[model samples]
Target: MPSRWLLSILTLILASAIVVACNGDNENTETSGKETDGGKPDDFVTLKMIMPGDESARMREFVDNELNDRLKNDLNMKLELTYIPWGSYQQKLELSLSTGEDYDLFWHGTPFVSGYKSKGYIQPLDELLQKYGQNLIKNIPAENFKLDQIDGKQWAIPSQAFTSAGKFTSVMVRQDLLESVGMTEIRTIADLEAFYRKMHAIDPSYYGYLETDRGHEVLWRELSGENLTAFDERNLFAVNEDTGELVNYVESDLYKKVAHLREDWVKKGIIDKNLVGNPQSKIDQENAGKLLFRVGAVSRAMENLQTAQKADSGAKLREYFLAPDKPRYIVAPSNEAYMIPAAAKHAERAMMFMNWILKSKDNYNFIIFGVEGKYYRIENGKIKLLTNDQLMYEWMWRNKNYFTAPTNVPDDVVRDMLHNDDNAKISRLFGFHFNEEPVKKEMAQVLTVYKEKFDLINSGLVGYNSGFSSAMTALKKAGYDKVFAELKKQFNEFNAGRP
Candidate 1:
């Protein structure tokens, strides 16, 4: 009924309308793919995280079924984990980062922090943390965050554990051995020594102390109350509490006393001679129920007690602070932290994951303990572990502030040690981080000298004064003076800037 021209115009109009309508539909679909809450679409991201430990098959299953399901539904992301054994962790991490591997996150510690930051292997987290890590900022204290900063930029987010302000050193003694020795309590180092001597005297076959090469270093730190600064990589330097001057920790009076005591103990048959080079001997003795006293961290004490109980039902354990009179707590620079490499493609997503983990109790608990009904169960407001077979490595993503207490330790004991109000004295040099750049060469030379010379003195194989003099002479020859001067200058600068 219409004219030919009118019919042609109508056909063009319909075609234009269809094209505009299709364009509108495409725009709507694209917008829908992005979430309004800043999250991505389902299955849009797969994050790779490398951690230190053997990968648990059970954990992998749970993550695939339980964790990924939730992450996919909520954040549109999933996690891929690569576990490296402790011995191979450092080497593998270096290799992975150097090769520009596509990793989103990894566990970091003190030894790696300075090196990683200085070399620009990791990115500053200031903006990412501000945008997505509000929960972390709220939960962790501002001062605690200062520990992760290098040159005024944050490179890592510290795990929610006792970083630098908790009781670390404690002596766990065998209760049955103490009772046999007629000792009720060990209040001081002298009391402990007496107990050890009595145990040895009662039974010549029983060793008084099971000493380990690394345990001795912790004991020395507890006794000296001096933090190992950058200049003291070998832990041979201490700051004078009175004058704040740098002093050789091995040459100090306290160190001399402890070293002499160790020497006397070694001669008196209190310490096993094989312990000097054989660190595993301590573990062997502990399992054999021959260990009388062991010095280590509070959690280690608890773990030892558990191990001792499993070995001998009659075994009982008691803990005591080595320096109860002057409780010294060093806020450690690193515990457990999540770091994003500079080459990571999913930096924002990694931070989002961290923020979500910190913010959600269910998420954190799931990561820490595993699937609630399967791996653990709640009993009377405490977590009762169901099986140790496929346990989540707590240190990998633990937040002690919101952690649930395990059944292996009493709730009260966990609270007392974790919230150690009585002995929560922050060190005078609490937040000081030693820049290793200035003295890198000196540090390497000194470390070699320390292992060759100072380790003997520390292990009580050599006399204190003679070994100290010899080690000091070697250190001086290795340019110890230069290292000390640089450290002192830095310390002064840090002190001047302290608020």
Candidate 2:
């Protein structure tokens, strides 16, 4: 009887051990599942973000303390931001990607999308986005997603604000000068020319038009109504309005006319002769009250005027939209995008961050506008300036949905500029992306020629006819014909697939 009782006791002990082992296995499985599927790991993770422009020390502290705490509570992640100045951003980004640095997300422009995708540095976010970025998908328009796609795969998340409809360039003239010249309004290019002449007559010391070298292209696009779309690194080929054929922009008659006009302005001393490669000079002159006229997008006119007024309180600015009579809206693809590198250790988290930015107004405003009460205040649904704590290049991440008007400008004016679609004119090739792989070499060579020859012509350093002719010859010699053919083939394929 004693032996039998001992046997029973041992058997019961063995059974209890089995049950304990099974429970341990279940717990291990659950923990593993949590780690692999969206749940936080035992150790915290840090996401490294690279962006353009310098963030103030105050801003950094706020982000690290306040923003990081919030992200940690919500995502179990912290953000480490690195700001590269605008001029050095591209080079630094390239080096970082090439070296396989331990970075997560970065700001990028549309031009580099294809190159980055082809190099395998960036990953397609279709699956991750669908899984984690539902808010992003919902907020951004379908057309915008199409713009960021290449070969039917999305490579980046485009900012939801001002995706395409903000291309409103106008001639900005000093109101005080306009009145001084007896001109209340400038209705046409001829009227602009007359104003420039009058302003030059009034104050020959002041530059009539303080436009930069790149402003030449802006003027050309405004006058011709034919947008210059880049085909390769070196060439801009615009679609012929009448024939629907692509033509080299520099060789076109319209380009020649604009060049001639530029030369005439230079001869008449209506434009600053020393404006080439000196873009800062325009800003300096405007602030010093030495510029009578300038050309830029209307959205920035008020801001520019406000800044100018700081230097000279009497300074007042007004905008005259080019071709007001025609009044057509020009739409292009979104140029700004946020991309995640394929080598990122935390891509899902990055997607989560993007989702947060798109969906939450607080998150978006924090990243864009800085600490609200410190940088700006909200009164009557308008944003009032408190301190210039704003990032110098805030537009880099501007989301239109959450954008607030500055106190200096009327809220209605800002709202109208972004949303008014009464005369909206969408481009036929609005979503079209030029694939430059086949003609990349030719494109490079053509771009070299442009830098050498076209800059001289546009800056009025060389005579119009000779400079235009020389640029055309140089382009043709650099295998422009091949580039054009490649662009035509790819454009045809793209057009055929358009729905």
Candidate 3:
């Protein structure tokens, strides 16, 4: 309670800081009204974008003093980016979209665009692309654009900038703990459980034996060796890649297998019963050198290793890919995106600005890596990032063609990240967009049920037998059948139509 209270206090302070900084920037928008080539200043459009993360005076200065100054001359457009702390991002994002006060568009994260589209907060970008985003269509592959499309209409610019070679889940274990247990590697579920047991015996005070930021069902599916693609996220619904059958993943035996495994780990004192929401808890513990394991993808492990080293210089962590025998699937380039609000006052300018960013490799790289000398520099053909925080929200604009890895990164990472999605298990539904429009209310209610009942079950706090049945019953009452039916119908048609 005390920690939550303190967090709440900090959230308010950060929110207030963001508001104050935004106000100052708004009053300081002298550059947003820069003159055009023919001396028409009205041609300049200032696109307002809302983002997540705390206010950074450094970033504000870089955008206004440097980035915007260049944009005023080249594209005749400017950007007004506002930050809302992660704690209050969704709430504030929805509020801004609902009100349309000082907001043109905002970041659209995965598993969220569906909800936003259902609520009519964001608009279709089909016409916008035809008119102003032509450069985007020319540069970005058609398959990549489908990531942000639903009902065959693009709702936002795709957020993938990596090679999209494919996505596979991996685990990061504390090497110190492994060596302490006289173990070298963990490649099996049995090995994982044994490692946890020995680690718990040494220090039961450690949180959970495993903590993952990735979707639970997807992670477990990889471990279970199931041929299922959780297209709807969090194992709410899935399509069997082999059979093309759509069904409720939660109701499948695969769900029961992993749930029971997690429960067993919990019973054996390997998993913490007091599971917290989100991967941020794991991040917090890792910073304090208390976390035992972290799970996500290969890139996630790489990022985790960097953060762990900063948290503890002596920290020894090793990354291992789960289900190594199976191919990693590429569903989309990335799950990050930015969507234009339907009520955006400058929708055309928003499209033009984004299109301009992708018009050239140099332009894209400049936006991401920042000034060549200050934020980054190339040494021996490799980029050296001087400040990681200069543009912390640069993930939203990742373009594989323009991506340059820092010197600290491994060459294989750079190679894999920049490649096309050909070498890996590309999903049959790679370009298939699931529309929740027909069953919006049902999906919402079922998702609410999932949050309330399934979070604990998925976290391994309780055995599947203890609560899984009741949750299924609740889901059925919440119209899970309708969702499943709709998904099945769509997947069948999509699969049949695919070449």
List lDDT for all candidates, in order.
0.65, 0.64, 0.66
Q: How do the residues 314-409 of candidate 3 rate in per-residue lDDT, one tens digit apiece? A: 656665555656555666666777788877877666766777778777777677667888878898877777764645445566665665566766
TM-score of each: 0.78, 0.80, 0.81
Steric clash count of candidate 1: 2
Ranking by TM-score: 3, 2, 1
Q: What would the per-residue lDDT of candidate 2 be over residues 1-499, giving only the tens digit for each residue?
A: 1245434533543343333223321100111122332444454678888987657886677777877887787667799888886556888998999888878888887667777877778877766666567677666655566556676567788764563332434566777677878888766777777777787776677777735343543465456766443332233566543345677666677767777777877887776677556655665676677877776554555556566667666666766655564433333435668888878877777877777766677777766666678766788776776654554245554556777667666554466456534444444455567766777788779778877878777667687767676677888899888888887888777667544
RMSD per prediction, one decimal? 15.4, 15.2, 10.9
| CA shift of 88, model 2, Å | 4.0
Model 3 stretches astray by more than 4 angstroms: 1-42, 165-168, 172-186, 194-225, 268-270, 273-275, 278-280, 287-292, 304-306, 314-319, 392-394, 415-422
**How many backbone clashes does every candidate have?**
2, 2, 2
On lDDT, the stronger of 2 and 3 is: 3
